[model samples]
Target: MVIYFTNQTGNTTDASVSSFTSIPVLDYTQALSPTTKPKFLAQLRDALINVGFLYLQNPPVSVATQDALTQKGFELFRQPLEKKLEIEMVNSPHFLGYSRLGAEITALKSDHREQFDFATELPAPGPDEPLYRNICGPNQWPDETAIPGFRQATEEYLSEVDALSASFTALIAESLDLPPTAMDGVFDEPQQHKLKLIKYPLPPSDQTSDGAGFQGVGAHKDSGFLTFLLQATPHRGLEVQNKAGEWVSAPPLPNTFVVNIGRALEALTGGVCTATTHRVSLRQEYFIDADGKPLGPRYSFPVFQGVSMDLSAENITLVVPDHIRDLVKDDKVKSDAEATFNKMFKTSIGEGTLVARVTSHQDVGQRWYPDILAKALQGQKDFVSKQ
Candidate 1:
């Protein structure tokens, strides 16, 4: 019933929200040299504090890299349905791989009319962590004969992206006032993270059905720390919700990665950097352009940069005020936060499910820490001599 993509009624611009307003573009281009580093950092710090997202231009990657990846991507997406399905998303445990149209459940009431996913190539882990034996595993892809140069281009694009993401992580740490060592122990030793190359293709006009992309993608907040989106050159549909609960068009900016802070940042900061809601806006088929003809579908590519899931959320105890903590203790605030987070990943919270995550709609917070830390310390001390 609720239209999530483009808000039904409200202001639609960068200043949509009262708290998380759109920030000025931070020109980090001068970060290349040692002398201008301070100036670059100042701009970055201001942007992060005011808005969790930024438009990154002149990033580490070159223009040639973008063009190459975009070309190879088109080839892969245009492959026959059977070939595309060879390494389908349904088969990937972590939801990594090529997906078909209507594969997303964005609206809750209906599936979105588009498909996108991620890929990662981490190295094999040593015995220190067996759970991640497959963290640096192979990416399953359709045979190259069907889509020539697909494998090579994709791998190259992924490598460049990985390096770029790491660079941004270090810079973000600097912005947060933490020593660069702050990133230690958080990422998997082998450094594996989810990286997607999205493609929102054109939709059909004559007929509409389960596959029509009108509801192309669902509305949701990002789940990780930061997302670096290399937008489609001709993109138009991306939208972000502002503080006032209104939707504003975030059309792709050329030569800029639409960067956004995600839930991990919010958790680490104890809610300082709010996880903003965003989704791809699907223009109806009947919607006409200024030319008096129906407009075609738009495209966008988002790469969600992240650390290992096994790591604990960052401790932002110092950032939040005592009053917010009190608000977090209230029944409504606690329940709502937990439920909202649970729904983001489609996990459960109620009783009787296999995992307690779904069932415990109640808030879990620092208030429970005193009692928990007391028992934990006793257990540690009691076990010290047994060894």
Candidate 2:
């Protein structure tokens, strides 16, 4: 699939798979300035339609704030194993808490990373409420005495990123040649966004080079609208798959966030905007120092901008222009069979999200929602059998 973009010289150029190497870097501040806004949007449009991933520079969050958040993540990971287990995700019905290494599954395989997940604090749903509403609830935070100021730093970062995501969503609407607020109605009041602090530890020396245990996180498309990832380390583990099924490296850039379109956005845009496949492959080199000593683990913080849980097929109203819709590629890479079940306009967003959560964290599901877990597993098997 070749995507054409107008370059600075006003000349059209094709971004073919062979020519697509690195992720495009777009300055967020440029999108704010009147003179540069047009150029930024053009680049953003191309990035979204073609690569589905880009490095965002000069984002709303300050360097100090990002550094503090990164520091807090490191501190949180350094805590005793017992402390982390105390707030294990298995204990949370909402799936908001710490997850030890290999606790989460992706692509039906264990992801070789430990993570802490949290979202906007909200009260649990009432007994008579729909089952999908169980996804909304307060987060399980670590002990403040053990990690002082960690909560403050994380919340501050989330607040700043929330504003940035909302602003970016508007820009995305404009980029699609729609009204700036065209997609605003899809977001719920007090939007429920999720953030994760992940640490991809070094694989065993013997397994690093082999294909045995290198998956930090298996290839998959994010289920939300957008994902703003802070690659808090100087390692090359993240890889984005192009339309041609080739993996392109997305290395870390200072003061930048690697932003990617998600499935919800793709569905909202009628496939005009893509949700690219990406994964993190663990390698010994990525965690070794120049002196050959281990440099600990690779850390990353990714925040997923959430949409309304009630959003369903009936709620979709935005229509992509004919010219823009023509840009949709026919040869786009397909996601895993299990993931394809989450397509928007087929079921309510909350329903799909709940199934995915229950499938991924079955321990939590078994304890809090055994029935849902069994149904989700059966659903996956049924879907896969048909495919």
Candidate 3:
């Protein structure tokens, strides 16, 4: 192994000791305190340096709240296409809203279901920071009519994870062998971050007819510092390919987020970490009854934490590889987040990208989508009552 000081990615750990096919159970609050900080940072550094996936459990948010969010999301998704269409993602141009399959695409392929995407509170950067000057803005919330607590819940989740991000980033600064508050100035204003609730519905087995991929979110590593993900396990959907090119399951855990560092983080650390490849394929389970049988739904919420576009999470030292140390800007560098995020959603300049491309009818979703879903559920209850 070419262990370069600049190359902080060091060596990939023995998966035999840390590999995860089953769910990982961990409590962030306990794992993140100052006393355990050293050990936790070492483990975290190792995980990012090798496994690239950390399963978490017992996050600050309760199971009930998360379940409620999921329940409300599915109910809203089932509402009349007309009612849900009222608040379209296209309305904001930043691309926040509900999107059906074909609305989101990754790796140049379209995804197979609907989802909601929103970043946490964004701060305006200085005039010199070109990236944030335009790209940073408050989230575009759906009108309360769609779902009374939708915006509030979404915002709350963001806050919870945002705090987690702050905690983790501080630890990372320490793991870099710097002072406790080393990263304070680095991520001064709330770090540029986002929170998402993605529900991958059971696609019709016959969905080959559609251009979308048979999988939910495709195999793609996050492009930022770190991602904390919570998923439903036993359902068997998430997969991460190892350095050996082997595919493994990312099963659900009780409460943790499946965390991983992105390429940018690797770049920041000067390759001291691993940003392993991951992907979701069309399930090949043999349908015993017949074709077109639907499987169960799969849900995941991945909260991404990042530094300002101008702040590089990576600041390699001379002890590291020259290439690694070079990642830090000797002179001011620009952040790629603005263009990258804009392109991901294909929205107007500075408007964050929606998950998928906009067709003629789908215009607004955030204006009041959450309320629409609630109303849809009410109608369902009413229908059942009448029956």
Candidate 4:
């Protein structure tokens, strides 16, 4: 159960200070059965409202496909350093390519993980289009000869998960007491989605004095509508923050994806759905061998479900029932300064998305969007000074 407290500003804070142990688990197969759909919806509603995270069992993607995709990840990262650098993220104006370990920053600190970012392959926008239109572009792929079947496997997995995420989103709409098609308008003809293949390496000995080293990915909310994460290793690293400001462990479970709501959904839903902050803090033991030597890196794959770039708060008209709206605190989920820049009403989805990309991957910004990057950096500096 969740507990909430109201501040003097009249905004409610979750304050879920109880022994909130485990993330709720929901079975996807049950959602397909007429007899069990109600129960599934009830469980989903609670998970969406309170935790904003859950373990999804028996999703559309099969275990074999999952294994294939992960195997490709291992192969991709195993390529020689020079070969990996061939498609480095700096080469892509769209920010779609490989990012070296500690190359990406979050919350002003370098994240200690190497990752490859890609999205639904789309052509670059025309020159006369809006600058945010640049976000849609082709990806930098590795040599097919070096990694046989890598592209095929990844594309297949992406296609399967894309369908799954869309169907699941419809279920989310139903759980919110809205028509299943309530969110249909927030998507474009060719929806834009993104995926990441991440590797969190073992921390150096000197950095592990406190047992935990640098952050794998810093504490932040996803900018999309939903995120389906496949934790491809046994190591425990991912953690979710509760309303009480406590970090709860979210370890890998067999044949299940750890799904979470994202900031985009929270904005479109008018705060009816929550988007909790989460981070990955790497522990030495998580990547240590029995002999105390370094083990292999921890791997994970997360697919971010996208929304229409044209969407903005001023145009959003999805109505939340009064009773459901009452369950949420005064439509103020987070009071942080960054939230201001991320709010849909403050900026269009495309602009907000571009700012986040430019800020996180500065190399892409410097190479492709210098002007916007300067403003973004100054804004961040201004926010930090105020804090």
Candidate 5:
């Protein structure tokens, strides 16, 4: 199926397979400026309420900083296989570390990407702590001897991303007409912030030339609060699914980060803001390099932002603004935030995160926490049965 995407500039581009009509590309600099704040907020509100995904141009980080980090990331990934495998993700109980190509699954299919997942450098929880606490621990790192500047560069970049994420979160709250600190509690202490350095190679030669085939990541929704994605390649393959189920290409643009809402945000706002589904796939046309050689690989940095594991501890209540609430009152939206919270608040944030991870990483789930995975899967069945 040929899909047409009309960008913010009204320029239409055609894709051989499914794609969206358009996705918003907003100015992050304007959103942060006091003089342009109101207009920026309005545009952001509209994008969130309608599309759930946006390209944030001119993010707070500097080009030099980004370049340095990207270099370090490339260095880490280019290390000898023996060196890179030292901190394999399977070795960690918290599921933080390296995952080789085809190691992680999406929708039951293996994703053709390799990545290193890092989180906040927090210590292990006490034995008396909750099960979710087990998910928070020190990140696995490569030896400084092998990759000289990798750790420092990554940690610095993570700090910048966290700050940028917080700024966006504030803007998101303001867009909803809520207090700037409204969602602060979710990120107070021991916050769950994950950074992944991912690389996607060209699909197998025998695969169809048509865009219908999956090349890298599969179609999936983010499970946390928000995501900040930095693409290092020129190929366009990140696709966002619209309400009509059509996928829209979100090609990589220089100096911009792709930001999107996640399930937690959707549940919090009663779906007033979208938590759209998206995926990654490199098409055949982008398979060759500038010199006509097979494309080396595609790299991306994605940060997954999550709230405190005990999000239900305070019995958080969401009072959606009348104006916004009325827009999605009908069942046009997939899940009603208020209704969902009223019914599933007990295990929403923590269990939701667990279910998302376990379902996606079958090997990790089976090896690490089989009991918890079993309970979570059963809970999923119960939830589905009710629906």
Candidate 6:
């Protein structure tokens, strides 16, 4: 059941809140069935083309498993500050591990949430491998003694989401009127998947000054193919930007996940599906703790599934159907699609994501990846500076 309130997107103008329309909801069970597939595909296409966001009901992950993971997430966060810091992200060149509060910068501002990121548990790349391959290394796990079942629950949950995301990608291909397996190349073996365990610390006050208050997380768009977010608590904050530039709040619903397209999909489709921008905001009630206080942290688990990092442009197949390609008549979009295609073919999705990380989280880049950070800055200058 998707509960959409009559809340106007943030931009609605009225003495009383204007009624905003609800985002579309897709029934995952029907979507995967032969009998209901055509209808499901039609709705899926409509949802992606129109809103680029939707509520996925009856996901592959069970409610009980989700609850177990949520409890584990809370347990991990509840560890003593010293214990939590043992696997700090700054220590990992691959950008795995925990990020303390105020460490992640977004939209040129500090995000008020701390998070732990885990990716495919692979071995560290050899020294001779491409620097970007460094991101493919093993994740930094918390001490099982300190947080028993944390690793087991997280790994299990990630595996479930990973399988579901792969299945959904094939459905996306079907919805686009392509061969059901047309999107398979993106998820070739060794594809990188990330699960983020995030906790948004409650704001001291409503003030938006000195970076001391709630910028729970600044506005941004996901950079991967598809993102599935599981909200453990009912604390409201997540909002999605609509076509009219209004921000609509997406509150938590039982057995539903708020899914959104990411930048890679937008590039791959030549703008047919958008990479919608969204952000998090905090309300006083949800701010259960005072500044420097910890009442109960708001937790969110977002799983990002993207193409194989090693995939190059030459090996990548852009899946925009001819009809969709014909619809992309805008010269700029065409150019961007071409450029992105060429860049990815030559480098890889792994490189693109790495560049994005360094650009957004400069401190992380500077500390753990200074060499790559310098190269990125040089590339930026060459691209934008007067010739």
Error of 1 at 371 (Å): 32
lDDT of 6 by residue, 137-181 (tens): 899999999888888888888888988887888888888888878
Query: Which ranges in model 6 have alpha carbons more than 4 Å from their true place?
Result: 1-5, 9-21, 209-213, 285-295, 324-346, 375-387
Q: Relative to the unseen true structure, what is the Cα RMSD of model 3?
A: 12.4
| Model 5 Cα lDDT, one tens digit per residue, 298-362 | 88889999876777735676566887666553464635555555543566466656666776665
Query: Which stretches of candidate 2 lie above 4 Å from their native place?
Result: 1-19, 208-213, 289-293, 329-342, 382-387
**How big is the positional error of residue 257 in model 1, measured in Å on the Cα after superposition?**
0.5
What are the per-residue Cα lDDT tens digits for candidate 3 across 53-114?
76655566667666666666656666677665565455544345556656765654567656
Two-way lDDT contest, 2 vs 6, winner = 2
lDDT, each prediction: 0.54, 0.82, 0.54, 0.82, 0.77, 0.76
Task: Give the alpha carbon lDDT tens digit for every residue of 1-387 in model 1.
Answer: 001122334433332134433434555566767887777665565455445566776777777877777777766667778777777765543344665665544433333444435466644445585332332455667687776776676667667777877777777666666565555544555555555555555544543454323545666777666787777555466666665555556655557677888765555545544566776755553244556675444545667665454543232223434443343323432344444444433421111111111111111111222343355446556786686
Clashes of 3: 37
Model 2, 167-255: lDDT tens per residue?
99999988889899899899888888899999988876666444423999999999889999999988878887765565666778788
Clashing residue pairs in candidate 5 (N, C-alpha, C atoms within 3 angstroms): 19-247, 20-247, 20-248, 270-337
lDDT of 2 at 110: 87
Point out the higher-scoring one by lDDT: 5 or 6.
Answer: 5
> Candidate 5 — worst ten consecutive residues by lDDT sum?
13-22
Q: Could you give me the TM-score of model 1 versus the true structure?
A: 0.69
lDDT of 6 at 10: 38
Q: What residue runs in model 1 are displaced by over 4 Å at the alpha carbon?
A: 1-23, 107-111, 123-137, 201-213, 285-296, 313-387
Q: C-alpha displacement of 233 in model 5, angstroms?
A: 1.0
